[model samples]
Every structure is written in structure tokens, then in C-alpha cells.
Target: MKAIFDDRQWHHDPKHFMANGKVLPSPEQPERITRLRHGAEAAGCDFIAPKDAGLGPIAALHSPEYVTFLKNIYTRWQRIEGAGEEVIPNIHPANRSDNYPKSAVGQAGFHQADTACPIGKGTWEAAYWSAQSAVTGADLLADGARAGYALCRPPGHHAYGDLAGGFCFLNNAGIAAERLRASGLRAAILDVDVHHGNGTQGIFYDRDDVLTVSIHADPARFYPFFWGHGNERGAGRGIGYNLNLPLARGTGDDAYLKVLDTALERVAAFGADVVVVALGLDAYVGDPFKGLAITTPGFGRIGAAIAGLGLPTLFVQEGGYLCDELGENLTAALTGFEGA
Candidate 1:
């Protein structure tokens, strides 16, 4: 399999993350690229730097205003007399439908979904390349590749069309699915991240062409505390196109595979020509989030199960933070898919 990546993705080194009301160093570190690259290599993936597909592919799913904010907000925040180094929102509107604000601070609040995604000087460049990597991987699939992997940093399952959250700036998986759809392929995104893909879900929630399914730790008491319930069966024309299978905390491999079987059935029923695996290894037993307890071998099984769908697949990196087994788990998943 071919893996898409860019060195610029390492430039967005975030400094702050607010968890449980206490600020700490961010877990979405540059070291992640090193570990993931080594893992992909171990899995026999040939590396290729992504071509600059430019902003058109990214704009396909993200809002224009939000994209502008992400690109210029860091500099605008620096112009403030007493602003912090990173652009983290301290205030937010009562609802997203409220009026837009002109002040840099107000725009930060309006565009940023939470404090997890901080805009630093290098954020825009890194995010742009991360998104381009996904686009490149999708292109490879469209051009007749059996499988491809996008090692996206600042993982992007939690972002929305206009709101950034959960350390995601732009939705890489969503962008990849959109790229495939534009090529006349029926795309189905299967997000196996430990957290719900609220951003990807929101992007295609009202459309029927692309199917979105996410299996994650239940949001009832997890990180994304909203929108991962079983009842969110898409809206309007997308009524039956969306599916969310939330698992209980600490659930392990067997249970996860059982749920994955159901998700694959739904994808097959959709008659999708391609599948985008929003791959997140954070569900590992030793991961910092401690959401689900999927062991290293469990990831291989998960990968093989997804491969059972017998459709072209693209694995776009999402979560999976720093851990000793991070790379090994990635290798296991990809090798399992290839071996299958």
C-alpha cells in the first residue's frame, strides 16, 4: 500500500490543551508523525509526499468563512495587545446560529468549537498539508490503487464544517470521502476512532450520496458528549444514510468486531464502491484516553474485518496518541488488511 504524508504536518506543534478545566501540554504532538511513519513502513507501505491539491478539495467540505478564519486567525490574535501565544477561544456564542463577530477574539469563539484545537503560527500550514495528504490518498484510489493510507496528524474526526474541536482543524477523512464522491464513486466512511466522527457526520448528515458510519466509545459520558447516540439516523434526504454504533467504555476486541460486522453490513447495503476507514488507534488498551480496550492484535482483527467488505479502502489517520505500542498497532492493522 502507498502512504501519503508531508513534513509540513510536523510544524503545527500545539502548546496547550484544556482538559477537565485544567490546562496542560497538548497530546497531539509532532512525534506522532515519526511513530506513524515507522509503523507504516514496517507494514511495507511505500511513502510518498502528497502533491499540493490546493484549497479546492478542502473547501468542498469546510465552510469558506471557517477556512478563512483558520488561515488568518493566528496572525489576527497576535495583533491583540494582551492575547495569549496560541489562539484558544475563551468565549463562545450561546448557539452557533447566533450572529457573527468581527473581533478576533469573538471570531475565535465563533469558529472554534472548543479549547482542544488551538491555532498557532504553524497550524494553518500543517493542517493544509494534512488535508492535502488525504486528498492525495483518495486520488490514488480513484486512479486504481487497491488501498492507500493517509497519515494525517492533528487528527480530524471531531471537527465540523465550520467548527474546530478535539484537536482537529480540518476534517481529513471527510475531505477524502468528498474527493472520492467528486470522482463519481459511491463513498462510505467507516470511522473506527475511539471518539465519534461528529465533524464528518455533520458534513454529510444532510446528503444521501455519501454514507457515514462511526463506531466509538459512547458519547453519553465520553469526550464528545453530544451526537453519537444510536438515534441520530441522519436528517432530511440523509435519513437512512448515517449510522452511529456507540460502545460501552472499556469494551474490547470481540465486542468491537461484533459491532463492526453490523457497520459493514450497512456499508454493503449502501452499495458503496469505496470505503474510507477513519482509522484511529486510540482505542488501544494503553492509550491515554482509556476509552475502549482494543489490544494490538484486536486492531489486526478490526482491519481484516473492514477488509472483508471487498471494496477499495483508504485509511485516514484520526486519533491514537503517544504510546509505546502506537506504531506496532498501526503496523498490525495495515498488515492485517493486506494479509486479508
Candidate 2:
């Protein structure tokens, strides 16, 4: 497999993360790239740097104004008289139905869905490059690669078309699916990340062309509390297109794979030409977040099952914190896919 990556992705180094009523060092750090790179190389993946795709690919999934906001938000936040080092929203609209705000503070709240995604000095450049990595992977898949991996940092499944959240500024999975669809292929995104892929789900919720499905921790007591319920089948033309399979907290491998069997069946029924796996290793048992209990070997089973679908696959990196076996977990999945 060819693994696409960009060194610029390390530029957005987040410092603080608000959790458990206290601000502490964030789990999303630059070291993640080092670990992920080691895993890709160990998995026998050929590393390739992404080219400058410009804003066209990303703009296709994100609004122009929202993209503009991300590019310039850090500079605008720095100019504030008493602004913090990073842009963290202090207030959010009771509902997003209101008009957009003019002030940088209000814009922060408007564009940012939570405090987890703080915009630092190099956030724009890093996020832009991270997105390009995913786009490049899609380009490789479209050009006839059996499979491709995008080592995207500041993982993107949590980002909405216009909102940044959960350390994700740009939705890489959504961008990859969109690019694949533009290449005349029916694309389906199967997000196996521990958290619901709310951003990817929201982007394709109304479109039947790019089918979106997520299997994650039950949202009733999870990070993305708003969406990811099983009943959120797509609406309008997209009805029955979106699928959410939320599992209970502490669910382990055997049970997880059983659910995955059902998810793959849905993909097969959809007749998707290609698949994008929103790969997240945070579901590991030792993960600091403690959301699920998927073992390292379990990831191999997950990968093999996805490969069984026999579709050209794009593995886009999502959330996985600093763990002792982080590299091994990632490599295990890719190895499983290759072996299968």
C-alpha cells in the first residue's frame, strides 16, 4: 500500500485540552505523526508526500466562507486585545439557525463546535496539508492503486462542513469520498472510529451518492453526544443511505467484529465501487480515553473484514492517542489487509 503524508501536518501543535473540569496537555500532539509514520513504514507501505492540491478539493466539501475562516482565524484571533494563544470558543449559539457573527470571538464560537479543536499559529497550514494528504490518497486510488493510506494528523471525522470539533478542522474522510465520487465511482465511507463520524455523516446525510456509515461508541454517553444514534437514517433523497451502528461502552473485539459483519453486509448491498475506512485506533483497551476495549489483534480482524468487501480501499487516519502500542496497532490493521 502507498501511504500519503505531509510533514507540514505537524505544524498545528495543540497545547491545551479541556477535560474532566481541568485544562491539561492535549492528547493530539505532533508525536502522533512520528508514531504513525513508523507504523506505515513497518507495515511495508511506500511513503509519498502529498502535492499541493490547492483549495479546490477541500472547498468541494467545505463552504468557501468556512474555509476562509479556517485559513485566517488564527491571525484574526491573535489580533484580539486579550485573546489566548489558541482560539477556543467561549460561547456557542443556542442553535446554529442564527446568522453568522462578525466579531472574531463570535466567529470562533460559530466555526468551532467544541474546545478540543483549538486553532494555533500553524493550524491553517497544517490542516490544509493534512487534507491534501487524504486527497492525494484518493487520487492514487482513482488511478488504480489496490489500496492507499493517508496519515492525516489532527484527525478529521469530527469536523463538519462548516464547523471544527474534536481536534478536527477539515473532514478528510468526507473530502476523500467526494474526490472518489467525482472520479465516477460510487463511494461509501465506513467509519470504524470509536467516536461517531458526525461531520462525515452530516456532509452526506442528504446525498445518496456517497453512502456514509459509522460504527462507534453509543452516543448516549460518548464524546459526540448530539448525533450518531441508530435511528438517524438519512433523510429525503438520502433516506436509508446513512447508517449508524452505535455500540455500548467497553465493547470488545468479538462483539465489535459481529457488528462489523453487519456493516460490511450493508456496504455490499449498497454496491459501492470503493470504500474509505475512517481508521481510528483509539478503541484500544489501553487508550487513555477508555471509550471501548478493542484489542490490538482485534484491529487485524477489522481490517481483514473490510478488505473482504473486495473494493478499492482508502484508509484515512482518524483519532488515536499516544499509547505504547500505537504503532503496532496501526501496523497490525494494514498487515491484516495485505495478508487477506
lDDT of each candidate versus the true structure: 0.94, 0.93
Report lDDT (Cα) of residue 305, candidate 1. Answer: 90
Worst 10 residues of 1 by lDDT: 153-162
lDDT of 2: 0.93
Per-prediction tally of clashes: 0, 0
lDDT of 2 by residue, 258-315 (tens): 9999999999999999999999999999888888999989999999999999999999
List model 1 lDDT by residue over 44-81, tens digit each: 99999999988999999888999999999999998999
Top candidate (lDDT): 1
Clashing pairs in 1: none
lDDT of 2 at 300: 92
Question: Which runs in model 2 stand beyond 4 Å of their true positions?
Answer: none
Candidate 1 accuracy as TM-score: 0.99
